[model samples]
Target: MRIAELGRRTGVPVPTIKYYLREGLLPPGERTSPNQARYGEEHVRRLRLVRAMVDVGGLSIAAVGEVFAALADQDQEERGLVRALSTVEVAVTPVPEHEDAEAAAQARAFLERQGWRSDEDEPALRALVGVLGTAREVGHDRFWELLDGYARLCGPLAEADLDYATDGPGGWLEREEALERVVVGTVLGDAALAAVRRLARKQAARRRFGNPRADCGTEGSAEGGSEGPAADGATAERP
Candidate 1:
């Protein structure tokens, strides 16, 4: 297919595809003549991946390039999924500014209590430390009380995530395709999980503390209930 056809098939504009080509996000199509090139299904798939990284994952061009570079670094035969994922995750996750040392210790201690082994430099761990530090700074120390429950709940979520990534819509995929699915899953999954949690919280709150006089079809009202705790705890934020 020509560039125009590739664009039509992928729903990305030709000019934007050219931009991605220049930015090294998309590989150049095979040169067929002085002014024309031919693209294949691989280019189509790559363009879709690029769009997902930009639109859903909210990655910058540089970050997408870094993720591509990380994917390229994986050995084709060995297909180091873990290493590729780690590199991609590091590329996408913002490095939090160093904050409370005690918060960092507490985050690590929480991981230890959960029997989770991870390097101190892990992006998620650092993010947790940052969040904990921020909470402490804002006088939300009570938020720490729910940390264990969050971890416990997240364990099943991780397993389910892996299951969905591996057994995708088309069933088992090749290593490269599977890696792509994992990338999209990890990025978009966080958003889906967060939104679902909010919905669940609304439902749970309605069941537990909603005003009895309020119409069932309407939004739950906590008119007669005590003020809910902050930082996403139910008794505080739900989960």
Candidate 2:
């Protein structure tokens, strides 16, 4: 594929893509000819991932770069992943969305029940309530049930994050850097959560109910059967 095609697929402008290339944010494309650079499937995949991180995941360029590096490092550890995931910031931006009466009622009820103060952006709370409101509107009861379990798991987790983020590395975080961290953390953290969710499901089945598929003599399945590299390539190194 050509650079034009990459831009088209990624919805990024050609000049911006070139800027990324120049900034070393993106790897150099193969030279099809002296004046023409040809991209391939790898470039396409990477560009899409970058766009998703910036546009949807709300990552800053520096943070996005760090995340891309950590993702490809293969030599990274859990702490490295934590560093990458902590690069994005969550701000209290009013979305300017008009909430329907019922949706408002549902969200209010959900938040009230969860005891989450809406005084801040509250990414975790917003995500949970949004999932519930959307689910109820779509005629599903399982979303609330899922939220119940997830909330029980996440409440303490949030406290842990607060403890660590404030006392650990993120404590030194500057304001401008917060956005970058917010972006990186939001994307990597989501990936981390996905890794955990996958493990949790397997654990609920294998050990919670005692399936024989897992190796015996342990309290639970190893790494809870996490994906690809187990929990992450971060947790276990490849020899």
Candidate 3:
């Protein structure tokens, strides 16, 4: 297909596709003539991946280039690809040098206590510390106190994620696809999980209070009598 057809098929504009081609984000199509080229299905697949990284994954062009390079490197083993994808995904913003040393130390300690194999200097670690520091400054120190519970919840999820990624019926994913999946999953899965959590929270609230409206705060009057939208509103809002 020509570039125009490629753009139509991918729903990307022609100029934008040219920009990606110029930026080294998309490989050049085969030169059928001096000014015309034909792109194959591989180009279509790559363009979709590029769009996902930029539009959904929120990666900068340079970071996407790095991720693609890592994915294409034949020498990188599975573990290396996973690490490289994660590093690029999480290290989009540089860690501030002035981040609180105490928070950094605490973050490192927490990781150590959890027996996770993360480096103290990792950008993700620094990012955690920065958030923790901000939480303390905002008088939300109890947020950090909830780390253990959050970790416990994450433990099973992480294990399940790895199990799915590495134990497919045909065996683990191919290196390139695995790397792409990791990046895409990390980016999109957060939104998916947040939606799931909200539904779960609504269900739990309904079970605990015997009425979802009662947990919405408006129905929880000082008299302790539930008064709000009756079954109709409840059914309308039910997940």
Candidate 4:
């Protein structure tokens, strides 16, 4: 195939394909003449994978390079390849997986049945299910719960992303910004959420007990057996 046809097939521009070839993300095409070159299925597949890494997965060029090298490494296990491809599929596909779609459908119904208005999150939910499926196969369901808690934030976060994605010069630029929003925002929001919860807990303590050290000696003790603010000997012994 020609470069134009390659770009058309990959949804990448012709110049971008050239740049990818230069960057070693895609291999050089076979030279048919001094100025003529022909890309084959390997080039197409590599280009698609490259596009998936940068465009959908939102990986930095350097990061994508590392991942590509890892994929090429013979030492990596099949599961590593599977996980990498799973990530690429999740990033590339427009919708969530069928298994995740079913799970999210059931979850949405469960929510509606409980009188909660949950916007459908088939893609996000399906992605979660896929992650969980992989996680379960590895015997790590607790990690799935941790990821679920993070996925819980996607609705509100996606709304924020929609705000930026819909604003300003609506073209590839805007679309690019939106994809960055989804990727970067997930990392930022998770960290922000954790900080907010910590701060909120401190603020709530101030209101309820009027002390930064309220939990120091609470009746129930701190959550998960964390030591309260009270020094062990500060409080009198109880009968």
Candidates' C-alpha lDDT = 0.79, 0.59, 0.73, 0.55
lDDT of 4 at 75: 38
TM agreement with the true structure for every prediction: 0.82, 0.44, 0.79, 0.35
TM-score of 1: 0.82
User: Where does candidate 4 stray beyond 4 Å?
Assistant: 75-239
Compose the digit string of candidate 1's lDDT tens values, residues 124-238. Answer: 8888888898999999987777899999899988877766656743466677876786788777787788899998997797789854443343233344244334311433332
Q: CA RMSD for every model?
A: 8.0, 13.2, 5.6, 14.6
Quality of model 2 by C-alpha lDDT: 0.59
Models sorted by lDDT, best on top: 1, 3, 2, 4
lDDT of 4 by residue, 1-239 (tens): 88899888878899888877777777678999998799998787667656655665556676656555544542333344334443433443345344544444445544454455533553444555565556656777455335445446655665665454345334323333334343344434445666888989777876787543235545434441344535333433433
In terms of lDDT, model 3 sits at 0.73
Task: Point out the higher-scoring one by TM-score: 3 or 4.
Answer: 3
2 or 3: which has the higher lDDT?
A: 3
Give the alpha carbon lDDT tens digit for every residue of 65-174 in model 3.
77767656646656665676566555354565668776777777788788888866677777789888888788887667677777899888776655555555356777
Task: Return whichever of 1 and 4 wins on TM-score.
Answer: 1
- Tens digits of lDDT, candidate 2, 27-69: 8998989999889876776676677776765566776666556
